[model samples]
Target: MASEGLHAPRERLTEKTLNLHHAIVSLTEELDAVDWYRQRADDCDDAQLKAILLHNMREEMEHAVMVLEWLRRNDTDFAGMLKEYLYTEGDIAHHED
Candidate 1:
Protein backbone atom coordinates (compact mmCIF):
# COMPACT_ATOMS: atom_id res chain seq x y z
CA MET A 1 0.00 0.00 0.00
CA ALA A 2 1.06 3.54 -0.62
CA SER A 3 1.78 6.07 2.11
CA GLU A 4 -1.39 7.83 3.29
CA GLY A 5 -1.51 10.73 0.84
CA LEU A 6 0.51 9.32 -2.04
CA HIS A 7 -1.13 9.27 -5.45
CA ALA A 8 1.51 6.90 -6.78
CA PRO A 9 3.62 4.04 -5.43
CA ARG A 10 5.99 5.25 -2.76
CA GLU A 11 8.84 3.26 -4.28
CA ARG A 12 8.46 5.22 -7.49
CA LEU A 13 9.06 8.59 -5.83
CA THR A 14 12.37 10.30 -5.25
CA GLU A 15 13.63 11.25 -1.78
CA LYS A 16 13.28 14.93 -2.59
CA THR A 17 9.68 14.46 -3.74
CA LEU A 18 8.80 12.64 -0.53
CA ASN A 19 10.31 15.41 1.55
CA LEU A 20 8.40 18.02 -0.42
CA HIS A 21 5.21 16.07 0.03
CA HIS A 22 5.78 16.02 3.76
CA ALA A 23 6.33 19.76 3.86
CA ILE A 24 3.23 20.41 1.74
CA VAL A 25 1.05 18.23 3.94
CA SER A 26 2.34 19.87 7.11
CA LEU A 27 1.70 23.31 5.70
CA THR A 28 -1.87 22.40 4.75
CA GLU A 29 -2.56 21.02 8.22
CA GLU A 30 -1.13 24.13 9.86
CA LEU A 31 -3.30 26.44 7.75
CA ASP A 32 -6.37 24.35 8.50
CA ALA A 33 -5.61 24.53 12.20
CA VAL A 34 -5.32 28.30 11.96
CA ASP A 35 -8.74 28.57 10.32
CA TRP A 36 -10.39 26.22 12.80
CA TYR A 37 -8.88 28.08 15.74
CA ARG A 38 -10.08 31.40 14.41
CA GLN A 39 -13.60 30.06 13.97
CA ARG A 40 -13.68 28.67 17.47
CA ALA A 41 -12.32 31.88 18.91
CA ASP A 42 -15.00 33.84 17.10
CA ASP A 43 -17.72 31.71 18.63
CA CYS A 44 -16.15 31.62 22.09
CA ASP A 45 -17.86 33.60 24.81
CA ASP A 46 -15.15 33.53 27.45
CA ALA A 47 -12.61 36.29 26.98
CA GLN A 48 -9.70 34.28 28.36
CA LEU A 49 -10.51 31.28 26.24
CA LYS A 50 -10.87 33.43 23.16
CA ALA A 51 -7.52 35.00 23.81
CA ILE A 52 -5.92 31.58 24.18
CA LEU A 53 -7.49 30.33 20.95
CA LEU A 54 -6.36 33.39 19.02
CA HIS A 55 -2.85 32.92 20.37
CA ASN A 56 -2.90 29.31 19.21
CA MET A 57 -4.09 30.43 15.78
CA ARG A 58 -1.14 32.78 15.45
CA GLU A 59 1.20 29.95 16.41
CA GLU A 60 -0.28 27.80 13.65
CA MET A 61 0.28 30.65 11.21
CA GLU A 62 3.91 30.75 12.30
CA HIS A 63 4.22 27.03 11.63
CA ALA A 64 2.70 27.45 8.17
CA VAL A 65 5.09 30.27 7.29
CA MET A 66 8.04 28.18 8.45
CA VAL A 67 6.98 25.35 6.16
CA LEU A 68 6.50 27.79 3.29
CA GLU A 69 9.99 29.16 3.89
CA TRP A 70 11.36 25.63 3.69
CA LEU A 71 9.63 25.20 0.31
CA ARG A 72 10.96 28.55 -0.88
CA ARG A 73 14.51 27.58 0.08
CA ASN A 74 14.32 24.14 -1.51
CA ASP A 75 12.41 24.99 -4.72
CA THR A 76 13.56 27.59 -7.18
CA ASP A 77 10.03 28.00 -8.58
CA PHE A 78 8.67 28.83 -5.18
CA ALA A 79 11.51 31.28 -4.60
CA GLY A 80 10.84 33.03 -7.91
CA MET A 81 7.06 33.24 -7.43
CA LEU A 82 7.31 34.45 -3.85
CA LYS A 83 9.79 37.09 -4.84
CA GLU A 84 7.58 38.25 -7.70
CA TYR A 85 4.31 38.42 -5.74
CA LEU A 86 4.99 39.04 -2.09
CA TYR A 87 5.34 42.50 -0.48
CA THR A 88 4.59 44.62 -3.49
CA GLU A 89 2.45 47.71 -4.00
CA GLY A 90 -0.65 48.25 -6.13
CA ASP A 91 -2.93 45.80 -7.95
CA ILE A 92 -1.85 42.24 -7.23
CA ALA A 93 -3.47 40.70 -10.29
CA HIS A 94 -1.60 43.07 -12.58
CA HIS A 95 1.82 42.03 -11.25
CA GLU A 96 2.30 39.78 -14.25
CA ASP A 97 2.03 42.68 -16.66
Candidate 2:
Protein backbone atom coordinates (compact mmCIF):
# COMPACT_ATOMS: atom_id res chain seq x y z
CA MET A 1 0.00 0.00 0.00
CA ALA A 2 1.17 3.52 -0.79
CA SER A 3 0.62 6.61 1.32
CA GLU A 4 -1.63 9.21 -0.34
CA GLY A 5 -2.36 12.35 1.77
CA LEU A 6 0.13 11.08 4.35
CA HIS A 7 2.92 11.65 1.85
CA ALA A 8 1.62 15.02 0.75
CA PRO A 9 4.33 17.67 0.86
CA ARG A 10 4.25 19.72 4.01
CA GLU A 11 3.49 23.40 3.71
CA ARG A 12 6.95 24.69 4.43
CA LEU A 13 6.12 28.10 3.00
CA THR A 14 3.16 28.57 5.32
CA GLU A 15 5.21 27.43 8.29
CA LYS A 16 7.93 29.92 7.49
CA THR A 17 5.44 32.73 7.07
CA LEU A 18 3.88 31.93 10.42
CA ASN A 19 7.30 31.88 12.06
CA LEU A 20 8.12 35.28 10.62
CA HIS A 21 4.84 36.73 11.79
CA HIS A 22 5.46 35.39 15.27
CA ALA A 23 8.89 36.94 15.31
CA ILE A 24 7.55 40.33 14.26
CA VAL A 25 4.90 40.24 16.97
CA SER A 26 7.48 39.35 19.60
CA LEU A 27 9.76 42.16 18.46
CA THR A 28 6.90 44.66 18.51
CA GLU A 29 6.05 43.69 22.07
CA GLU A 30 9.65 44.18 23.08
CA LEU A 31 9.67 47.61 21.48
CA ASP A 32 6.54 48.56 23.38
CA ALA A 33 8.08 47.43 26.64
CA VAL A 34 11.15 49.47 25.93
CA ASP A 35 9.01 52.51 25.21
CA TRP A 36 7.31 52.04 28.56
CA TYR A 37 10.66 51.93 30.31
CA ARG A 38 11.68 55.08 28.50
CA GLN A 39 8.58 56.84 29.74
CA ARG A 40 9.32 55.65 33.26
CA ALA A 41 12.81 57.02 32.92
CA ASP A 42 11.31 60.46 32.37
CA ASP A 43 9.77 60.38 35.83
CA CYS A 44 12.93 59.01 37.47
CA ASP A 45 15.08 61.61 39.21
CA ASP A 46 18.11 59.34 39.72
CA ALA A 47 20.82 59.83 37.13
CA GLN A 48 21.78 56.13 37.05
CA LEU A 49 18.21 54.98 36.36
CA LYS A 50 17.88 57.59 33.64
CA ALA A 51 21.10 56.46 32.00
CA ILE A 52 20.13 52.78 32.01
CA LEU A 53 16.69 53.54 30.62
CA LEU A 54 18.10 55.72 27.87
CA HIS A 55 20.56 52.99 26.90
CA ASN A 56 17.82 50.38 26.79
CA MET A 57 15.62 52.69 24.74
CA ARG A 58 18.39 53.14 22.21
CA GLU A 59 18.87 49.39 21.95
CA GLU A 60 15.16 48.89 21.45
CA MET A 61 15.06 51.43 18.64
CA GLU A 62 17.90 49.58 16.96
CA HIS A 63 15.98 46.34 17.19
CA ALA A 64 12.91 48.08 15.76
CA VAL A 65 14.93 49.36 12.84
CA MET A 66 16.21 45.85 12.14
CA VAL A 67 12.70 44.47 12.22
CA LEU A 68 11.47 47.29 10.01
CA GLU A 69 14.10 46.42 7.41
CA TRP A 70 13.02 42.82 7.47
CA LEU A 71 9.42 43.82 7.05
CA ARG A 72 10.27 46.08 4.13
CA ARG A 73 12.13 43.24 2.41
CA ASN A 74 9.18 40.94 3.04
CA ASP A 75 6.88 43.39 1.12
CA THR A 76 5.23 44.74 4.24
CA ASP A 77 3.85 48.30 4.45
CA PHE A 78 7.07 50.25 4.50
CA ALA A 79 5.45 53.67 4.89
CA GLY A 80 3.50 52.58 7.96
CA MET A 81 6.49 50.98 9.54
CA LEU A 82 8.61 54.04 8.89
CA LYS A 83 6.01 56.28 10.43
CA GLU A 84 5.76 54.12 13.53
CA TYR A 85 9.53 53.94 13.83
CA LEU A 86 9.82 57.70 13.72
CA TYR A 87 7.08 58.15 16.27
CA THR A 88 8.61 55.67 18.67
CA GLU A 89 12.06 57.17 18.32
CA GLY A 90 10.71 60.60 19.09
CA ASP A 91 8.91 59.30 22.14
CA ILE A 92 12.09 57.65 23.38
CA ALA A 93 14.08 60.84 22.94
CA HIS A 94 11.60 63.11 24.73
CA HIS A 95 13.47 62.79 28.05
CA GLU A 96 17.11 63.78 28.05
CA ASP A 97 19.31 61.76 30.36
Candidate 3:
Protein backbone atom coordinates (compact mmCIF):
# COMPACT_ATOMS: atom_id res chain seq x y z
CA MET A 1 0.00 0.00 0.00
CA ALA A 2 1.08 3.58 -0.64
CA SER A 3 2.30 5.63 2.31
CA GLU A 4 -0.65 7.95 2.89
CA GLY A 5 0.51 10.16 5.77
CA LEU A 6 4.26 10.49 5.34
CA HIS A 7 5.58 14.02 5.72
CA ALA A 8 8.96 13.23 4.15
CA PRO A 9 10.10 11.40 1.05
CA ARG A 10 10.04 7.58 1.31
CA GLU A 11 13.66 7.09 0.23
CA ARG A 12 14.99 9.58 2.79
CA LEU A 13 13.72 7.73 5.86
CA THR A 14 15.90 5.19 7.68
CA GLU A 15 14.64 1.67 8.37
CA LYS A 16 14.05 2.35 12.05
CA THR A 17 12.20 5.57 11.29
CA LEU A 18 10.11 3.79 8.66
CA ASN A 19 9.26 1.06 11.10
CA LEU A 20 8.24 3.62 13.72
CA HIS A 21 6.08 5.31 11.12
CA HIS A 22 4.39 2.04 10.32
CA ALA A 23 3.74 1.36 14.01
CA ILE A 24 2.34 4.86 14.54
CA VAL A 25 0.03 4.55 11.56
CA SER A 26 -1.10 1.11 12.61
CA LEU A 27 -1.84 2.38 16.11
CA THR A 28 -3.92 5.22 14.69
CA GLU A 29 -5.92 2.80 12.58
CA GLU A 30 -6.44 0.46 15.53
CA LEU A 31 -7.69 3.28 17.75
CA ASP A 32 -10.03 4.39 14.99
CA ALA A 33 -11.35 0.86 14.69
CA VAL A 34 -11.92 0.72 18.42
CA ASP A 35 -13.98 3.92 18.32
CA TRP A 36 -15.97 2.74 15.32
CA TYR A 37 -16.70 -0.66 16.85
CA ARG A 38 -17.80 0.82 20.17
CA GLN A 39 -20.07 3.33 18.44
CA ARG A 40 -21.63 0.56 16.36
CA ALA A 41 -22.11 -1.55 19.47
CA ASP A 42 -23.79 1.33 21.27
CA ASP A 43 -26.16 1.98 18.38
CA CYS A 44 -27.07 -1.60 17.49
CA ASP A 45 -30.51 -2.95 18.50
CA ASP A 46 -29.69 -6.63 17.92
CA ALA A 47 -28.27 -8.41 20.97
CA GLN A 48 -25.95 -10.83 19.11
CA LEU A 49 -24.60 -8.11 16.77
CA LYS A 50 -23.95 -5.78 19.68
CA ALA A 51 -22.00 -8.45 21.47
CA ILE A 52 -19.94 -9.07 18.35
CA LEU A 53 -19.23 -5.37 17.94
CA LEU A 54 -18.17 -5.03 21.59
CA HIS A 55 -15.87 -8.01 21.21
CA ASN A 56 -14.31 -6.46 18.10
CA MET A 57 -13.87 -3.17 19.98
CA ARG A 58 -11.94 -4.92 22.74
CA GLU A 59 -9.76 -6.65 20.14
CA GLU A 60 -9.00 -3.34 18.51
CA MET A 61 -8.10 -1.90 21.94
CA GLU A 62 -5.68 -4.80 22.40
CA HIS A 63 -4.06 -4.04 19.05
CA ALA A 64 -3.71 -0.36 20.01
CA VAL A 65 -2.08 -1.21 23.34
CA MET A 66 0.34 -3.63 21.65
CA VAL A 67 1.46 -0.97 19.22
CA LEU A 68 1.82 1.52 22.11
CA GLU A 69 4.03 -0.93 23.99
CA TRP A 70 6.13 -1.38 20.86
CA LEU A 71 6.55 2.39 20.74
CA ARG A 72 7.59 2.49 24.42
CA ARG A 73 10.15 -0.24 23.79
CA ASN A 74 11.59 1.40 20.67
CA ASP A 75 11.62 5.07 21.70
CA THR A 76 13.43 6.21 24.81
CA ASP A 77 11.27 9.32 25.22
CA PHE A 78 8.14 7.23 25.05
CA ALA A 79 9.59 4.80 27.57
CA GLY A 80 10.39 7.65 29.96
CA MET A 81 6.97 9.28 29.63
CA LEU A 82 5.14 6.01 30.04
CA LYS A 83 7.15 5.23 33.14
CA GLU A 84 6.33 8.62 34.58
CA TYR A 85 2.60 8.47 33.95
CA LEU A 86 1.37 4.91 33.57
CA TYR A 87 -0.12 2.77 36.38
CA THR A 88 0.22 5.40 39.05
CA GLU A 89 -2.49 6.42 41.49
CA GLY A 90 -2.41 10.15 42.15
CA ASP A 91 -3.30 13.47 40.58
CA ILE A 92 -1.90 12.55 37.18
CA ALA A 93 -1.10 16.03 35.90
CA HIS A 94 0.62 16.96 39.15
CA HIS A 95 2.59 13.69 39.24
CA GLU A 96 4.87 15.00 36.49
CA ASP A 97 6.33 17.58 38.82
Candidate 4:
Protein backbone atom coordinates (compact mmCIF):
# COMPACT_ATOMS: atom_id res chain seq x y z
CA MET A 1 0.00 0.00 0.00
CA ALA A 2 1.17 3.49 -0.78
CA SER A 3 1.48 6.04 1.99
CA GLU A 4 -0.05 9.48 1.45
CA GLY A 5 3.45 10.95 1.28
CA LEU A 6 4.25 8.99 -1.90
CA HIS A 7 4.26 11.06 -5.06
CA ALA A 8 4.47 8.09 -7.40
CA PRO A 9 2.43 4.91 -7.47
CA ARG A 10 3.45 2.17 -5.05
CA GLU A 11 3.88 -0.27 -7.87
CA ARG A 12 6.53 1.93 -9.39
CA LEU A 13 8.71 2.01 -6.28
CA THR A 14 11.44 -0.53 -5.62
CA GLU A 15 11.40 -2.65 -2.45
CA LYS A 16 14.43 -0.81 -1.07
CA THR A 17 12.81 2.53 -1.85
CA LEU A 18 9.61 1.53 -0.10
CA ASN A 19 11.55 0.40 2.95
CA LEU A 20 13.53 3.62 2.99
CA HIS A 21 10.29 5.58 2.73
CA HIS A 22 8.94 3.77 5.77
CA ALA A 23 12.07 4.50 7.76
CA ILE A 24 12.04 8.17 6.73
CA VAL A 25 8.39 8.56 7.64
CA SER A 26 8.92 6.89 11.02
CA LEU A 27 11.87 9.20 11.73
CA THR A 28 9.82 12.26 10.80
CA GLU A 29 6.92 11.24 13.03
CA GLU A 30 9.24 10.53 15.96
CA LEU A 31 10.90 13.93 15.60
CA ASP A 32 7.51 15.62 15.30
CA ALA A 33 6.35 13.94 18.49
CA VAL A 34 9.52 15.07 20.25
CA ASP A 35 8.86 18.66 19.19
CA TRP A 36 5.23 18.52 20.28
CA TYR A 37 6.12 17.06 23.66
CA ARG A 38 8.79 19.67 24.24
CA GLN A 39 6.40 22.47 23.33
CA ARG A 40 3.71 21.09 25.59
CA ALA A 41 6.18 20.70 28.43
CA ASP A 42 7.29 24.28 28.04
CA ASP A 43 3.72 25.58 28.07
CA CYS A 44 2.33 23.42 30.86
CA ASP A 45 1.97 25.03 34.30
CA ASP A 46 2.05 21.77 36.24
CA ALA A 47 5.55 20.60 37.13
CA GLN A 48 4.69 16.87 37.17
CA LEU A 49 3.01 17.05 33.78
CA LYS A 50 5.94 18.96 32.42
CA ALA A 51 8.38 16.34 33.67
CA ILE A 52 6.31 13.55 32.07
CA LEU A 53 6.20 15.40 28.80
CA LEU A 54 9.95 15.92 28.87
CA HIS A 55 10.52 12.20 29.49
CA ASN A 56 8.22 11.29 26.62
CA MET A 57 10.09 13.72 24.43
CA ARG A 58 13.36 11.99 25.24
CA GLU A 59 11.85 8.61 24.34
CA GLU A 60 10.75 10.01 21.00
CA MET A 61 14.28 11.26 20.44
CA GLU A 62 15.58 7.73 21.02
CA HIS A 63 13.15 6.40 18.45
CA ALA A 64 14.20 9.08 15.99
CA VAL A 65 17.87 8.22 16.42
CA MET A 66 17.17 4.52 15.88
CA VAL A 67 15.39 5.28 12.62
CA LEU A 68 18.23 7.61 11.61
CA GLU A 69 20.74 4.85 12.30
CA TRP A 70 18.73 2.50 10.11
CA LEU A 71 18.89 5.10 7.35
CA ARG A 72 22.63 5.49 7.80
CA ARG A 73 23.11 1.73 7.57
CA ASN A 74 20.94 1.39 4.46
CA ASP A 75 22.02 4.47 2.51
CA THR A 76 25.62 5.18 1.69
CA ASP A 77 24.98 8.86 1.06
CA PHE A 78 23.49 9.33 4.52
CA ALA A 79 26.31 7.29 6.02
CA GLY A 80 28.88 9.55 4.43
CA MET A 81 27.11 12.74 5.48
CA LEU A 82 26.58 11.56 9.06
CA LYS A 83 30.17 10.43 9.34
CA GLU A 84 31.41 13.79 8.17
CA TYR A 85 29.09 15.99 10.22
CA LEU A 86 28.33 13.93 13.34
CA TYR A 87 30.51 13.90 16.53
CA THR A 88 32.89 16.48 15.13
CA GLU A 89 34.47 19.19 17.30
CA GLY A 90 35.51 21.74 14.66
CA ASP A 91 33.40 24.17 12.65
CA ILE A 92 30.76 22.11 10.82
CA ALA A 93 31.00 24.27 7.68
CA HIS A 94 34.73 23.54 7.48
CA HIS A 95 33.91 19.89 6.80
CA GLU A 96 32.73 21.00 3.37
CA ASP A 97 36.24 22.18 2.50
Candidate 5:
Protein backbone atom coordinates (compact mmCIF):
# COMPACT_ATOMS: atom_id res chain seq x y z
CA MET A 1 0.00 0.00 0.00
CA ALA A 2 1.06 3.54 -0.71
CA SER A 3 2.17 5.60 2.27
CA GLU A 4 0.44 8.80 3.32
CA GLY A 5 1.95 12.20 2.45
CA LEU A 6 4.19 10.75 -0.23
CA HIS A 7 5.13 13.58 -2.59
CA ALA A 8 6.05 11.31 -5.48
CA PRO A 9 5.04 8.02 -6.97
CA ARG A 10 5.70 5.08 -4.66
CA GLU A 11 7.14 3.04 -7.54
CA ARG A 12 9.79 5.70 -7.99
CA LEU A 13 10.96 5.59 -4.36
CA THR A 14 13.63 3.28 -2.99
CA GLU A 15 13.10 1.15 0.13
CA LYS A 16 15.34 3.40 2.20
CA THR A 17 13.44 6.50 1.10
CA LEU A 18 10.15 4.82 1.85
CA ASN A 19 11.29 3.89 5.34
CA LEU A 20 12.47 7.43 5.95
CA HIS A 21 9.14 8.68 4.72
CA HIS A 22 7.41 6.44 7.25
CA ALA A 23 9.61 7.74 10.07
CA ILE A 24 9.07 11.36 9.07
CA VAL A 25 5.35 10.89 8.89
CA SER A 26 5.33 9.18 12.26
CA LEU A 27 7.38 12.00 13.77
CA THR A 28 4.95 14.55 12.38
CA GLU A 29 2.01 12.70 13.85
CA GLU A 30 3.68 12.36 17.24
CA LEU A 31 4.53 16.05 17.34
CA ASP A 32 1.01 16.94 16.38
CA ALA A 33 -0.32 14.72 19.16
CA VAL A 34 1.93 16.50 21.63
CA ASP A 35 0.52 19.84 20.56
CA TRP A 36 -3.02 18.59 20.84
CA TYR A 37 -2.45 17.13 24.27
CA ARG A 38 -0.84 20.32 25.50
CA GLN A 39 -3.78 22.36 24.31
CA ARG A 40 -6.23 19.97 25.89
CA ALA A 41 -4.36 20.05 29.15
CA ASP A 42 -4.35 23.82 29.18
CA ASP A 43 -8.08 24.00 28.57
CA CYS A 44 -9.00 21.29 31.03
CA ASP A 45 -10.66 22.34 34.30
CA ASP A 46 -10.36 18.96 35.99
CA ALA A 47 -7.05 18.45 37.69
CA GLN A 48 -6.92 14.70 37.17
CA LEU A 49 -7.79 14.91 33.50
CA LYS A 50 -5.35 17.76 33.05
CA ALA A 51 -2.63 15.65 34.62
CA ILE A 52 -3.47 12.78 32.30
CA LEU A 53 -3.34 15.02 29.28
CA LEU A 54 0.01 16.44 30.34
CA HIS A 55 1.36 12.95 30.93
CA ASN A 56 0.22 11.87 27.48
CA MET A 57 1.88 14.95 26.02
CA ARG A 58 5.17 13.96 27.62
CA GLU A 59 4.80 10.47 26.17
CA GLU A 60 4.27 11.97 22.75
CA MET A 61 7.41 14.04 23.20
CA GLU A 62 9.29 10.86 24.05
CA HIS A 63 7.96 9.25 20.90
CA ALA A 64 9.11 12.23 18.84
CA VAL A 65 12.57 12.03 20.40
CA MET A 66 12.81 8.33 19.64
CA VAL A 67 11.92 8.97 16.02
CA LEU A 68 14.52 11.71 15.89
CA GLU A 69 17.12 9.31 17.28
CA TRP A 70 16.12 6.79 14.63
CA LEU A 71 16.60 9.44 11.95
CA ARG A 72 19.99 10.36 13.42
CA ARG A 73 21.03 6.71 13.33
CA ASN A 74 19.80 5.97 9.81
CA ASP A 75 20.79 9.21 8.02
CA THR A 76 24.32 10.52 8.14
CA ASP A 77 23.30 14.12 7.54
CA PHE A 78 20.84 13.96 10.38
CA ALA A 79 23.46 12.36 12.61
CA GLY A 80 25.92 15.11 11.79
CA MET A 81 23.43 17.89 12.38
CA LEU A 82 22.29 16.38 15.68
CA LYS A 83 25.86 16.06 16.83
CA GLU A 84 26.55 19.67 15.88
CA TYR A 85 23.39 21.18 17.36
CA LEU A 86 22.27 19.00 20.24
CA TYR A 87 23.30 19.58 23.90
CA THR A 88 25.63 22.50 23.28
CA GLU A 89 25.81 25.56 25.53
CA GLY A 90 26.91 28.18 22.99
CA ASP A 91 24.82 30.09 20.45
CA ILE A 92 22.96 27.55 18.30
CA ALA A 93 22.37 29.84 15.32
CA HIS A 94 26.09 30.47 15.04
CA HIS A 95 26.57 26.91 13.90
CA GLU A 96 24.23 27.51 10.97
CA ASP A 97 26.23 30.41 9.59
Candidate 6:
Protein backbone atom coordinates (compact mmCIF):
# COMPACT_ATOMS: atom_id res chain seq x y z
CA MET A 1 0.00 0.00 0.00
CA ALA A 2 1.25 3.52 -0.87
CA SER A 3 1.88 5.93 1.97
CA GLU A 4 -0.10 8.84 0.54
CA GLY A 5 1.18 11.22 3.24
CA LEU A 6 4.69 11.21 1.84
CA HIS A 7 3.62 12.14 -1.69
CA ALA A 8 2.18 15.57 -0.89
CA PRO A 9 5.29 16.86 0.90
CA ARG A 10 7.50 15.47 -1.83
CA GLU A 11 5.44 17.20 -4.49
CA ARG A 12 5.57 20.47 -2.60
CA LEU A 13 9.34 20.26 -2.28
CA THR A 14 9.71 19.64 -6.00
CA GLU A 15 7.58 22.64 -6.80
CA LYS A 16 9.57 24.82 -4.45
CA THR A 17 12.81 23.69 -6.02
CA LEU A 18 11.55 24.55 -9.49
CA ASN A 19 10.51 27.98 -8.30
CA LEU A 20 13.99 28.61 -6.86
CA HIS A 21 15.59 27.69 -10.16
CA HIS A 22 13.35 30.13 -11.99
CA ALA A 23 14.30 32.88 -9.56
CA ILE A 24 17.98 32.15 -10.08
CA VAL A 25 17.72 32.53 -13.86
CA SER A 26 15.78 35.75 -13.61
CA LEU A 27 18.21 37.22 -11.08
CA THR A 28 21.15 36.32 -13.31
CA GLU A 29 19.73 38.44 -16.12
CA GLU A 30 19.30 41.37 -13.76
CA LEU A 31 22.88 40.97 -12.59
CA ASP A 32 24.00 41.33 -16.17
CA ALA A 33 22.21 44.65 -16.52
CA VAL A 34 23.59 45.86 -13.22
CA ASP A 35 27.13 45.22 -14.41
CA TRP A 36 26.61 47.19 -17.60
CA TYR A 37 25.19 50.15 -15.75
CA ARG A 38 27.87 50.15 -13.09
CA GLN A 39 30.64 50.72 -15.59
CA ARG A 40 28.73 53.54 -17.18
CA ALA A 41 28.25 55.06 -13.75
CA ASP A 42 31.92 54.84 -12.99
CA ASP A 43 32.73 56.69 -16.16
CA CYS A 44 30.26 59.45 -15.50
CA ASP A 45 31.81 62.65 -14.17
CA ASP A 46 28.73 63.82 -12.37
CA ALA A 47 28.80 62.94 -8.68
CA GLN A 48 25.03 62.68 -8.34
CA LEU A 49 24.68 60.22 -11.19
CA LYS A 50 27.55 58.16 -9.87
CA ALA A 51 25.95 57.96 -6.45
CA ILE A 52 22.66 56.81 -7.90
CA LEU A 53 24.28 54.19 -10.05
CA LEU A 54 26.41 52.95 -7.17
CA HIS A 55 23.30 52.61 -5.03
CA ASN A 56 21.51 50.60 -7.68
CA MET A 57 24.50 48.38 -8.30
CA ARG A 58 24.83 47.64 -4.60
CA GLU A 59 21.16 46.72 -4.52
CA GLU A 60 21.63 44.29 -7.39
CA MET A 61 24.51 42.63 -5.57
CA GLU A 62 22.36 42.28 -2.51
CA HIS A 63 19.63 40.71 -4.59
CA ALA A 64 22.01 38.19 -6.09
CA VAL A 65 23.17 37.20 -2.62
CA MET A 66 19.56 36.77 -1.50
CA VAL A 67 18.81 34.52 -4.46
CA LEU A 68 21.97 32.57 -3.79
CA GLU A 69 20.89 32.00 -0.22
CA TRP A 70 17.57 30.67 -1.44
CA LEU A 71 19.27 28.37 -3.89
CA ARG A 72 21.63 27.08 -1.22
CA ARG A 73 18.70 26.35 1.07
CA ASN A 74 17.18 24.17 -1.65
CA ASP A 75 20.42 22.27 -2.32
CA THR A 76 20.93 23.99 -5.67
CA ASP A 77 24.48 24.00 -6.95
CA PHE A 78 26.72 27.04 -6.35
CA ALA A 79 29.10 26.05 -9.11
CA GLY A 80 27.76 28.66 -11.54
CA MET A 81 27.35 31.66 -9.26
CA LEU A 82 30.90 32.80 -9.87
CA LYS A 83 30.40 32.07 -13.54
CA GLU A 84 27.50 34.47 -13.54
CA TYR A 85 29.72 37.16 -12.01
CA LEU A 86 32.40 36.61 -14.62
CA TYR A 87 29.84 36.69 -17.41
CA THR A 88 28.54 39.98 -16.13
CA GLU A 89 32.04 41.42 -16.21
CA GLY A 90 32.41 40.38 -19.84
CA ASP A 91 29.08 41.98 -20.58
CA ILE A 92 30.34 45.28 -19.16
CA ALA A 93 33.19 45.29 -21.64
CA HIS A 94 31.06 44.34 -24.63
CA HIS A 95 27.95 46.40 -23.95
CA GLU A 96 29.32 49.70 -22.65
CA ASP A 97 28.41 52.69 -24.73
In TM-score terms, which candidate is top? 1
Q: Compute the lDDT for candidate 2.
A: 0.69
Candidate 5 lDDT, tens digit per residue, 54-97?
A: 99999999999999999999999899989988998878878677
Instruction: Give the TM-score (vs. native) of candidate 3.
Output: 0.91
Question: lDDT (CA) for every model shown?
Answer: 0.94, 0.69, 0.93, 0.94, 0.94, 0.68
Q: What is the alpha-carbon lDDT of model 6 when measured against the actual structure?
A: 0.68
- Summarize candidate 1's per-residue lDDT along 15-86 as a digit string, tens digits: 989988999999999999999999999999999999999999999999999999999999898899999999
Clashes of 5: 0
Give per-model TM-scores. 0.93, 0.57, 0.91, 0.92, 0.92, 0.56
Candidate 4 residue 21 C-alpha distance from true site, Å: 0.5
lDDT of 2 by residue, 1-97 (tens): 2212223354544665655665577577778978887998998999999999989888888887777677666645665656556546445544344
- In candidate 1 the C-alpha lDDT for residue 12 amounts to 96
- Give the lowest summed-lDDT range of ten residues in model 6: 1-10
Candidate 4 ranges beyond 4 A from true positions: none
lDDT score, candidate 3: 0.93
Give the Cα-based TM-score of candidate 2 against the true structure: 0.57
Which residue pairs in candidate 5 collide?
none
Give me the overall lDDT of model 5.
0.94
Model 3 alpha-carbon miss at residue 73, Å: 1.5
Q: For candidate 2, what is the total of clashing residue pairs? A: 0
Give the Cα RMSD of candidate 1: 1.5
Candidate 4: minimum summed lDDT over ten consecutive residues — where? 1-10
